[model samples]
Target: MTATVAAPAIRVQGLVKSYGDLRVLRGVDFDVARGSVFALLGSNGAGKTTVVRILSTLLRSDAGTATVDGFDVAARPGEVRESISLTGQFAAVDEILTGRENLVLVARLRHLPDPGVVADDLLERFRLTDAAERRVATYSGGMRRRLDIAMSLIGDPPVIFLDEPTTGLDPQARLDVWAGIRALAERGTTVLLTTQYLDEAEQLADRIAILHGGRIIADGTLAELKRLLPPATVEYVEKQPSLEDVFLAIVGTDPDSEPADVITLEEQR
Candidate 1:
């Protein structure tokens, strides 16, 4: 059998960020193993994006140590930048360029000699081949989002930071992006995703950390976190079963069927 590597893809300790007087991140710490998917969840202003920015070398942390692929984000910023890619909250593709053109531009920026080959490969990988020649301005929201993520892969970085990757996508579009994220993690890319969507965190995260007030309130696997609260007893019914049917099956229903809120094990008193 071949030996497996033990080096972590990302590591951070005492990470802090501030804006004027408000301290955003207060001694944040986390480590992501190579080829794993780690998610950071938080409400707005929880410092999730600030953490990503610092790790990806887009912004400097006020005080901390951050490393990506074993390269220090501050002391070895050039190497750290070369080892990671970041897709911010917004889709950043050039609207005037065609899908193919946008990818080729990224390839060229990476100094790849055969930009056309890289563009063609990414177009097919992202299912954008048919629309490759079409202007990005005419693309749908999902298509633009796909192009944005595809561009991030031009350098094939070992680690990727996706900050609210599905923010504006429709439900179907959101699922498509989720699938793409899963594919990346499966292929040994370490992903640190930040999102407000609980469902997205539940779906793609191998390990999750919840941020509240700029600190990690909870951290664990989904089941571990859910177990922290009461167990959620999920029930299902076929056909036109009323909420009354569900409640009656669990707790005796009132004669009026009162249209009361259903309580799961988590919400039960």
Candidate 2:
């Protein structure tokens, strides 16, 4: 007997979208495998957000097709919406509500049974339990992003769209969001992450597709993409720390640790 192959969690073929004179997505195509993170790597105005909106049923494509969880985005938008969660560039958390209140509110909105229980579980999962009752106004960027993500997972959607999930965050806060994304993929959820940060893609995506001029310029695993370039040259030069190194050293240096690793700006030069 022939074994059946599981279908991709997300499939987009020849997707086209336009805004009057501006053509955003020109025949875009890609597939996201189950339980994997797919990064739509691109710069601003590369139509990354356009692709996501179409996939989430918030916008329609002029041509081509997209499906989520085996349901056609155009024909069965309701089913597609049910199977996916979308977290846009900015956090959608309520500043007035406590972290726990925000989660419970989403649970109640989804009409889930035992909303409180669901909220508690998610607070624990996202490491927000300790700050559960604290108003979001006092939460840091990382904490707010975590709660936003936790709310998105209330119904346990199989697919998630993270549009520039780490934009505008400090380095440490960005790492926090990356951790949450990894946990999602570990639990068998398909993630479609759109970002301009190449390092973010490198750190989280199972596959990366670079979009430029409204089309995919390159698509592959990091190793595969690297192969497109000439072999890397190995060489050594005088070692010097940059401003980022100086900043990190100043911010994260230990009181009792040796000062050898922490170089002054003068030394960096």
Candidate 3:
């Protein structure tokens, strides 16, 4: 007997969307396996956000179909919402509230019993336990972003949409967020993120889809995408120091700098 294959966590076919005379997405098609990271890459105005909005039920597609966890996005918005969480371009935590309060608010909104316990658990999981009582206003950008994701997990949704999640983060913060995203996939959550950063896609996606002209122009694993391009002629030249090296030379070593900061700078470059 043939072994069974699990259905995709997300599926879209011929998806189209428009605003008045402006067409945003056209004939897009893709599938995301359960517990895998699927990245949608596009330039600005390439309709990346449009796709995310539609999948999360914030916007309806003008044509075609999309399903999350087997429930039709258009026909079963409630079910779709129940199965997914979304963290948009900006952090969504309340600035006036402490990190713990923000999480507790989400838990209470979710109507989960023992909201305080849930809040504490998420705080600890995200490594925000020490800062849990500090108001978000005093938190760093990375901390705020982490809190946003922790808030999204209050319901333990099976899928997550992170739309340009690290857009404005510093190099260290961006890597920190990337680690959190990987942890999510390892825990069996389907992650669909849209990003303008090509390296981000290359670093995280199990599969990638390039959206252009409001359509999915290419789709595959990173290796498969590379294969579509002509092979480069091999050449060797003297290696030159990168901008990072220049930065390090100028700044020198700071006794106060954390070791992790050095690792983050290297990884980003």
Best TM-score among the predictions, by candidate number? 2
For residue 241, give model 1's deviation from the true position in Å. 12
* Backbone clash numbers for all candidates listed: 0, 0, 0
Q: What are the per-residue Cα lDDT tens digits for candidate 3 across 106-154? A: 9988999999999999888877898999999999898899999999988
The lDDT of model 2 is 0.91
Deviating ranges (above 4 Å) for candidate 1: 1-5, 232-269
TM-score of each: 0.84, 0.91, 0.90
Question: Judged by lDDT against the true structure, how good is candidate 3?
Answer: 0.91
Tens digits of per-residue lDDT for model 1 on 98-187?
999999998988899899999999888877888999999998888888899899988899999999999977665776788889889888
Q: Provide the lDDT at 184 for model 1.
A: 90
- For each candidate, the alpha-carbon lDDT, in order, equals 0.87, 0.91, 0.91
User: How do the candidates rank by TM-score, highest first?
Assistant: 2, 3, 1
lDDT accuracy of residue 47 in candidate 3: 96
